[model samples]
Structure formats: C-alpha cells, structure tokens
Target: MTVVIGFEGSANKIGIGIIRDGEVLSNPRRTYITPPGQGFLPSETARHHRAVILTVLQEALEQAGLKPADVDCVAYTKGPGMGAPLVTVALVARTVAQLWGKPLLGVNHCIGHIEMGRLITHADNPTVLYVSGGNTQVIAYSERRYRIFGETIDIAVGNCLDRFARVIKISNDPSPGYNIEQMAKKGSQYVELPYTVKGMDVSFSGILSYIEEAAHKMLESGQCTAEDLCFSLQETLFSMLVEITERAMAHCGSQEVLIVGGQLFVIKSCRFFFSNLTIFLFSKSVEFHRFCIDNGAMIAQAGWEMFRSGHVTELPDSWITQR
Candidate 1:
C-alpha cells in the first residue's frame, strides 16, 4: 500500500493530509478568516498558512499514526491559486519530500477537487461544475484531459458571494459563502438582480457591481433586509450556474453531475433541479465534508493518481501557477 502526504495552501486555508492508497488516513486544515467587511489578502493568507502549517502537518501525522519515513511520497497543490499561498505550500512540500527522501508530485487545485469528488462519490464520467473562491467552470473529461466546457468570464461565483458579503458587512468567521447561505435561508423577498450568461460562459462582475449599489440604496431606504439581498443573490447566481451546467451536461451527454467547490450552495441550487440528471450530492455523507471543500486529502488523492500514472515533479521543475 502506498502512503502519500499532501499539502494544500492555495488560498486562505492551509491543510495537510495523508492518504494510504484509496483510503484517507487523516486530513487536517485551518482557515485564515478576515473580519467583517474585509477580504483576505494573499500576503496575509500566506503568513497565516506559514504560521499554522507545520502544526497542522504534525496533527495529520499524529492522527494517521504515521512517521515521515512511512510515507511513500509527498504531494502539493501546484497552481490555479493565489501565488503567495501556492508558493508557501510548494516550498514546504519540497522541503518535506527532500527530507523524507520521497518522490514529489504537484497537483492542480481543480483536478484535486475533481479526483476527490470522484473518489468519494464513485461517479464515473460526470459533468463537473467547479465553483470555488477563485474558480468557476463546467468541465468534462475529453481527449485525455478535463476540458472546460463553460466557465465564468469574470469573477468566480464564490468571489461574487464573498464580495457581496463584504458589501453587506457579514462576518467571515466560517466563510462568506456559508454566511450568505444561512442568511438566504431566512430571506423572503426576491429583489431583482442581473442574470448574465454569455453563451457557455457566465459573468458576475456586472451583477456584483449592480448589487453593491442596490444593496447600499435598498438597505438605506429600508426597502429590503440584508437577508433579502443574500437570498436574491443566491437565486440569481445559482440559476445562471444551473443553466450553464445543464447546458454543458446536455452537450456532453453526461448522466452524472458532480458539484465541486461551493458544494453546499451548488448542491442546494442544482439538486433535483435538473430533470433526469443523476446528481451526486456529497453533503449527505458527513465524512465527505472535508473532501467537499479545499483540503489536503484531495491533493494527496490527486497526487496518488498522478504518481500511479508515472507522473512526478522533479526538484528543479517544481513551481506554482496562478492560472
């Protein structure tokens, strides 16, 4: 059985996990939360990661009951994330691999989410809707690679939610998306918001701008509550996502639909909304919560797949990408 340790510090979160073949041994993570009305900067996020990463790594090892020598290889997120946070993870992963004399592998953050979702759900050949703090895309496996079928032409869905949360002055204790979801649950009013979908791609910048102005005016005029705006935002944004995802799935002729990144919100919006589509919702399985979101075990699992496929990152070639 192969054992792999993975590091992920691609954004505001820092996580370390170990996987033994198909089973996750341990996954531990910490988030860098900003105060209300503020967003986490890359430099601050990286600093937070550097502060807690080693402690989290030790926790993972302890939880997995494994020593460094027992690990077969080390893996880390390589790209499509904040540069500072990605580099922080890559540097630590490289150091650990060299110290342990283990092979090093670099994983794509998006592929990490996809592989982990597949691992947990066993949904083969599903149309994927990947929505995160920084990424939004509809993807399908084709020609030996996961090709983008549709995506955001501007900011990601999660970013839209986060920016809206800032506009409304919501606390970022757990997450902006989570806060918005909670607020949306109590919302009754459906304020009109712009819904922009350009062919296969969607745009959020316009919606964000429009809502920012509307939120200020409406909240000041006592016309709508913050909850109302939150609910309206979710409805509009998720509808666009569902529309594009449905279109992509139909085009790809896929039966299974896997929701990645903003799992809870997307699942709520897309589940049972698509006629005759097999929706794989990970939220039902409590064990999948960590895997559903950004975590190190996903990175480890992706790296394990790559390593078994004879892929490895040499020391000299290890680098980060912010695609």
Candidate 2:
C-alpha cells in the first residue's frame, strides 16, 4: 500500500511516474532528440531534463490522481548513466522528497529495467537482455544479485547503431535506432560486416569503424545504398546478440527471456528469429512501453521493492554513481 513517485533522467530522456503496490499508476517521459549527424551531449541532455521535468511530474501526478502530499516516498535513478543528467534528476528527487516530507530512495538504472520487465511479464526468473544507449548485458538473478553473464567489451550495441546513423545522416526525430530499423527493412543485400564476439562478451567498436569506412566507399563509388548497409549491420549485430543470449540461456538453464530498454524496439523485426527461446518481449506489451526505456515508473517500482526490503538512503547518504 505504498505510493512512490520516481524521477529518471539518467540519459537523454526525462521521465516522471507514480507506482503503488508493484503496479504502475502513471508514467510520462520526454526525450531530447538531436538532428541528423548529431549526437546528444550530456550538458544539452541535462538542460532538456531540467526544463521539462516539472511539467512531466505534474502530468504524472494528475494521471495518477494523487497530490504531492499523498506520496509516501520519492525515488530516482542513482547511476550508471551520464553524470550531468543523473545529477539533474537526483537533485530534483532530493528537492521533491524534502518538499513533500517523504523518504528518498536511490535506484540503480539497470536494475530498474530488470525489475520492471519482471513485474510486467510475471516471469518468475528469466534471463535478461538489457540493451540501451549506454549498456548491453545478458543478466540472470542468483543469490539476490543480478549477475552479468555476457556484456559488450567496447561500445554498446545501441551506441554503435546511433553512431552509424550519424554517419548516414539519419533523422533523430523518434530515434536513430528506430530509423535504422525502418531503413533496414528496405535492404535486400547482406553486406558483410565484422562480427566480434569474445567469449561471453561482444564488441561493436570494430564493427562501427568498418561500417563507417564502408559507408564512405559506398557514397564515393555509388556502389551500395544506405539501406543495404543498415540491413547488413542489423543482421550481423543482431545475430551476435542472439548467439550470446542463447549461450547465456543455455548456461543459466532458463526457458524464458525478457528483453528491456530502448534498443528492444529496434530488433522487433527479428524477435521470432530466435528458435526455442520463449522470448517474453516486455516492450511489446501495451502497458509496458514506458518501462522499456529509462523511465520513472521503473525507478519507482524498483525503489518500492527496495523500500519494502528495508533499504533506504539517509539524507546525508544520497549519492549518484557513473558505473
């Protein structure tokens, strides 16, 4: 019977949400989108979060039919995200907690995604693939901690896709990854790209470098289209992801797989391509879209879980982490 309000701005998106008893009451978020050939800077992203946070907070409260005084706790992402953005959201959370005379809780950004996915799918314990702009990991829960079975060695898959989109000058209206997915649908040829998987981990920097060179050559020689490049890149990278995920599943002995984060939408076309894997695509669920990204509802839910488990941050102990 706890009512928690969460704020999340760990990256480019700013979100506000309310949750009660493991159920999301309201989740509202906004992303800071840049133009073609541009990447989001931390300072600019933080500014966007600061600008729209109050409005989003108001909307979330209204949607939840609750007032600030009704909230029992305030939660916010503590880290593993951009410093400026994380600090911005943390500051807001601290302010809200103080103003409302509510307890404050700091949540891990990655765990927030996992907990929200599990809450939505009701999968007892599933192997998780957490893919986002800044993170890529295959995780499993054991002994109360989420252990990383496989992860990226270098750049994250989503970051690589975003950089590739910049090379091709794709619009960032919705997202670069979404644009790449759409363009990849038109591709008929599978241009070979490097696939680097080291043991349980994968690497994407080399692939990104190779694709940048290929893109330049294609543009110069008029031999290949951007769509073809997008298609080939998606095929190669997604195959690597599936392969590693399968290996983790086999090792962990889990039949259900939960996928979370913004990049999940990019690989929706290949969802059924994995054989024998009962993928509980959390992002596909109608009510779970906001939780898929770095949103406040996930933070609130995770924080509430921690709170119920008797975990809370004292006023002087509030902090943020980059790892």
Candidate 3:
C-alpha cells in the first residue's frame, strides 16, 4: 500500500497525518484559538502553524510508528484557504519532501474533504454539502470533477457563525461554532434573522449584520439572552443549509448526501434534517473532531488518490491560492 504524509494549515488549525492507502494511520492537529470577541488573523494563524507544525508532524509519525523514509509521498493543501496558513504548511511539506526524497502532491482543499468523506463513509456518487469557515458549496462529481451546484455569495456559513460568536463574546477554545451549538441547546426563545438564498447560492453577510444589530438591541433592552440569539441564528442558518442541500439532492437525482467540513459537525447535530434524507455523515464517531475540522488525514487520503492517478507537483508549481 502507498504511504503518504499530509500537512494542512488552511486556516486556524495546523494538522499532520500519515495514511496508508485509504486507511489513516495517524492524525494530529492544533487549532489557534483567539479570545472572545475576536477572530483569527492569518498572520497569527500562520505563525502558530509554523511554530507547531514540526511537533505535530513528529507526533503523527510517532503515532503511526513510521519514519520519514517509510513514507512514499508528501502532500499539502494548495488552494481555497487563507494564504499565509496555506503557505506555511506548503513550505513545511516541500521541506519534508526534499529531505526525504519523496514525491510531493498539491491537493485542492475542497477535494481533500470530499475524498476523505468518501473514503470514511464509502458513499459513492453522493451529493456533497461542503461547509466550512472558508467555504460553503453544494457539489457533485461530474466528468471527474467536483462541480459546484450552489455556493455562498458572500461570507461562508462558519465565518458568519464565528463572527457572530465574537459579537456575543463566546469562547473559541475548541471552536466558536461548537460553543454556539451548546449554548443554543439551552435557548428557549427564537429571534427572527434575515434569510437570503438567491437561486442556487446563499448569502450570510446580511443575516450576520441583522443578527448583530438585533442582538445589541435585545441585550440593551433586556429582551433576549446570548443563548436565545445563538439558538435563533443556528435554527435560521441551518434551516437554509438543509433547504439548499435538499435542492441540490433533487437536482443531482442522488439519494445519498455526504456532509463534510468543519461546519458538518454542527450540521450533523441537526437531527431534524438528517431524518428526511439518506445522509452519509463522514467521520461520525472515529476521530470525529479531526474530520469535522480540517485535518491532515483528508489531505493524505486525497494526495494518495492523486498519486495513484499519477499526479505529482514540482516545486515550481507548488504555489498557494485563496479561491
């Protein structure tokens, strides 16, 4: 079986993973948690990755009981992410590949998530709902490509949630989204938020703006608690996600839906939506947190797939992009 080591520092998390064929041998990651009322900065996040990536890589190798020489290839996320973070991980991957004399693969971040979801859940040809801090899209495989059927016109869903969390000063230890989800469970009131979905795309900036203003007014007037606002935001946004996913499913004529990305963790908790569809939620239990957030295992898996398909990237072609 082909062995691969993957690096992922797309946003706030820095991860290293080792995989053999489709099986993940090790997955180690660290998230850069900013304080309440703040969001992650690319420079700071990149510095965090640069500081801890080697430690994370060593831990992954130790966990897998493998040496640098044992790995057949090295992979790193190449695009659709924060530039500084992506470049940080890419430099590390390139250094490791050079040191070990291993082939290097530049993987599309979105494709990595989709490939890992497919590997973990074995959901063939399913409509995909890819939601994360940096991305939100409904995708389907067509002619060897994951085509975007729908997407966000403005900020991503997770970004909106994170920014909203900042408005209410929520903890960012694990994630702003997870904290919101927990607080929402305690919420009994539902505040109305704007819902904007135009054709196949969704927009979150308007909703985010509206909620920020409403939360401020409500807090000032003693009309609502943070929990109530969190609950309302989750309900409104997740309902929109469910609606769009169903629309994509209907258009693609697929019975199975694969939910992947950091936001999938929150979405999976929406039992009301899963009950209505044949949903294949990846990394549901095993390493649930790792898979839910961006991790090296997905990158390793995607890289290995590309290697098997005879794809390799030279150092000259290893530039990063934020699409």
CA deviation > 4 Å runs, candidate 1? 262-291
Could you give me the TM-score of model 2 versus the true structure?
0.93
Among residues 3 or more apart in sequence or in different chains, the pairs in candidate 2 whose N, CA or C atoms overlap within 3 Å are none
Model 1 lDDT-worst window of ten = 281-290
Angstrom error of the Cα, residue 52, model 3: value is 0.8
Off by over 4 Å in 3: 264-268, 276-291
Write down the worst ten-residue block by lDDT for model 2. Answer: 282-291
Tell me how many clashing residue pairs each candidate has: 0, 0, 0
lDDT of residue 321 for candidate 2: 90
- Note the Cα lDDT for every prediction shown: 0.85, 0.84, 0.85
Error of 1 at 34 (Å): 1.0
Pairs that clash in candidate 1: none
Candidate 2: list runs displaced more than 4 Å: 270-291
RMSD of each: 3.7, 3.6, 3.7
